[model samples]
Target chain A: MDVQAFKQRILPVQGRLFRVAQLFLRNREEAEDALQDVMLRLWSNRQQLETYQSLEALAVQMTRNLCLDKLKAHSRQKMATDGDFPEVQATTATPYQQVEAADSNELIHRLMEELPDQQRFILHLRDVEEYSFEEIEQLTGLSVNNIRVILSRARQRLRDSYTKANDYEADY
Target chain B: MKPTIEKLLEKYYDGETTLDEEKELRAYFQQENIPAHLQSHAPQFRYFANARSEHPSLKSINALANRLNAPEPNWVVRMGSWSVRLAASIGLLILGFGGGLVYNQLRPSAGKGTDLSFISETAPEKSLKQTLAFEQLAKTSASERIDAINQSYEITQADQEITQLLLNTLNFDSNVNVRLAACQALARFEREPSVRDGLIQSLKVQTDPNVQITLIDVLVTIKERRAVEEMQRLAENQEALDAVRLKAEEGVQSLNQAGNAPS
Candidate 1:
């Protein structure tokens, strides 16, 4: 596609795409790289881009795939580097200890990162991007009910993580 | 407002709130005043607000525009327009490299004259080794590697091995001149999918003023529509060289026109 066409059609949603990628990759640089790669791929296939049902959904799907691939590659690299060591769990910190930690922001950040891929993605699309259930369903190719279930689970996990962090502070 | 917000928050937790209801909940939490009992969920609401505020770097968008807009490289037009001067430069470059055993190895058939097409025909592994050599040389000085790159360009075509070497040099070569030359060499092979990708990728990591300018020029001259985004990015970077930034701005305008004009 031409520059004007690309900017008009694809550039508008880049922020959402970047946020979605960040949710999965959790690294700004990697997310940016993934976005650029996705954008380039879209540009290359511009001839067919118009054929897609929704360009925004297609962009999200591409970012999801790219981020998943990046996550897999990252895990493989981690495995290679951390041979014989068990993976560290994010929740290893005792509930009391996590609450005692002063930075709730960091706690929430870690908890969000530790969420299941699908749940985190759903949470990001709904809560952060504020996309409609129909839009989420379209983008994710999951039923609206399934998305609501996953999103509800993600919210519960966040609320639990947040309360656990806060309750410790309240107790002490 | 408090009762309504509390109800919406409950529904939000259950993922039962409509988008408008959730938006209402978000707006309420963003307000300065909140009942003490309902303040507990403020952080999660604020997190969503912060996340929504997060934006992709404009620089990336500009780079994307730059890449998508760039016209497909016309090898025939480019080669025809500059072959003689390019050949002369290559002759000088080969001499600069001291046409030694390496040159002999580069040209297996002695009678074929000085055409560099044979360089592209060289074993792919040899070019990979050349790229590796460049990676090691990057530690010493990019200046030292500049001559090696110039020599390589004279012989190497747009083959996979040479493209990798040029890409590495473009991104990692410390010397601006070497990177600039790499940009030029890569520009010639922009028709190759790999080379095109390498050039686009180089724009992200490249920081030097001269290399950035050369890369921008190559992208614009080739009518790379996607480069409008990168040009926009360069134009926006306060730290970028003023001249380069202006050039990028001008490129964006011209490319925008070119891309938008009737095909």
Candidate 2:
């Protein structure tokens, strides 16, 4: 593909690619960097881009792989210096403490931050991005059945935590 | 209607619901008065809805695309012509040196005043760094602009141009981190009246809560009394974030107290 074709086909997917990077990297600057890197890769391989059925799926898969690589490198550096792998801590707070401290949206954000990386990515893809199971399977290389199981677990976990937090407020 | 929703919720949890059913669930939760039992699920759906709005700046993407598409220079042809260019540059250097020697011989009085040359020599170096910083600030990458802001610290003199550039960056940069860096850099020149006024004005326009809070803190640190009114407005503005509002309220109180106290 020529430059104009590359821009038309690949440039528009950058927003989705950025979000995918942000989902894995969890930092805006790094996500932007990852997006740029993925775009560059796509540009170099533009000749073969038309062969793919979906450009967006290709962009998303590339973003996911790149972010995972960055995360792996980051954790390796952290491990070398800190001598321990970072753990995801469940930050529990009293219902009253959070009621006035953060809005419900912020509360949900904190809860989502605690989710495992796979579940978080799957949930975001399925719900916010609204990708069909087949599309998600194409992007993630997971069987549709496996994707559903992960999605089910992610949703239930979010529901349970969200209810536990707000149920206390309902009592008041 | 409640029974149907409950059944859909079951299907949702089991991952059996189609995209349309999930959309229905999201739409139902968006209503103001959701049933009490279903209230807990509202935030997650709201989060999904909000997440769709999170997007990267397209301007930066276009900049990246343009940079990638720009043609690469033909280095092979340039290398083939390098010998002629090198010979031309050497001859020009010799001619410049000979002309400078003759001019020096003809104007012997010029050497007596060393201060003039000293000023001329140092002035351009300062402006050179400033010029480079100014150009870097226009680049699309956030980190490059941040590096430019850091470079501004080396420009020892209090320059009006640098101050204005930093103010514009603090006020209008698309990236939050770049704006934050500009804010911190501006604080170093708080003694300048324009810097002080520019920061106070910035508080009125800044929408990001982090930038707003930082501006408030910088204003309070610099003790700009005029900022107290802006802080009051921010505190009273219902749309401001809760954390920002609280900070502004605190800022108003402290500035008022500072005003009443004797130095």
Candidate 3:
């Protein structure tokens, strides 16, 4: 793949790739960095790019792996510095007033952020990105049936939390 | 039609809905007059619709493309393996020695009292980290800049320079998340008069819903009464998204209530 071909083929999928990165990283800046790294890696391996059946799937997989690596590195650093300043952690905690005042959209966003990482990522790919089970399997290396099960669990979890939160709000 | 929609919702939770079925569900939820029975599900679908629009900036993409399109240096590729290894080791040695020399010079003399010496040892390290973080904020990659802001948490003391940089980021950073992080970081220095004024000013310029919401949250948390008018402006801005406007309105109400309460 020449530079022009690479741009034509890969640049268009950056939005999808970036969404995957953000789903995992939960930070736009980190996701943008991950997207750039994925693109650069794909370009360096452009000679073998055509061998893949799905370039978009390849890009998503690379993004997911890069985000996982970043998460791992972040956790490792956290562990090394554990207990150094517990008060500092408390500063970022959501103010209680905000919780009482959260709108439905904010409530749902918080619920989504609280989902398990695997479930959240699958939910994002299926519902937000609208990837098919087969496409998701290709990207995640999970079986199609496994993907369906996980996606079901994710959807159900969101529904459960959304309803529970609304019910709590209704009581007030 | 309601029965069909209910059936599709069941399939959606079971992960059996086809892409088209999911689209139909999204469209149904997007309507303003969704029945109360189905209203709870609307936010999730709305979230999905919003998430679909999340994307990186075109400027960053173009920058990455240009960087990759640039010609690679042939000399490095042409170097022999042994020569490359030798050169790398020599580079590392110089860097190590030079870093050690700088550290020694930066370290305070050891003969002082233990408490004073301890404070001096940490003082330089904090400033060094602050300097590195300030430099990182100028880099093109938003991630590098965020990392720089994260480093500011370690400095303990509220340096005027870092506060100004963060305020600048909150007002002007191209990435919403970067600006949001800056807002959160600034909350640590909420007591500073300048920081409070900067945040109140930021409420006027921020248009992104997420950042606007966060700025309001931070301002509210710090009980910045001055922010109430700015929040009222955002609340009345017709162009603002419903969520942002609602948040601003709520912020105004809360700030006003707090002001009225006898301390």
Clash number for each model: 25, 0, 0
TM-score of chain A of each: 0.80, 0.78, 0.80
How should the candidates be ordered by lDDT, best one leading? Answer: 3, 2, 1
Candidate 1 per-residue lDDT over residues B1-263, each given as its tens digit: 76788778778888899988888887887665678887678767766775676666677777766666554454446776699778889998988677776777767666365345444355443543454465477455555566556666555345677778878878877667878877886777768787766776777778887888888888887778877887898899999999889988988888898888966
Residue B70's C-alpha lDDT in candidate 3? 68
lDDT of 2 by residue, B129-223 (tens): 45435455564477767777777676677678778888988888888998999899899999999999999999988999999999999999988
Candidate with better DockQ, 1 vs 3: 3
For candidate 3, what is the TM-score?
0.50
lDDT by residue for model 1 over A12-57, one digit each (tens)? 8899998888777776667788999999888778889888989999
> Measured by TM-score, how close is model 1 to the native structure?
0.51
i-RMSD values for every candidate model: 5.2, 4.9, 5.4
* Weakest ten-residue segment in model 2 chain A by summed lDDT: A81-90
Per-residue lDDT of candidate 3, residues B19-127 (tens digit): 9999999989866678889987888997787667766877788778777766344334556666888899999999999999987876645434656746654554344
Tens digit of lDDT per residue, candidate 2, span A1-172? 8777887877777878887887777666677889989988887787788899999998999999998998888673211111110111113545563342245666676677678988999999988888899999998899999999999999999888878877776686
The TM-score-based order of candidates, best leading, equals 1, 3, 2
Give residue A148's lDDT in candidate 2 (0 to 100): 96
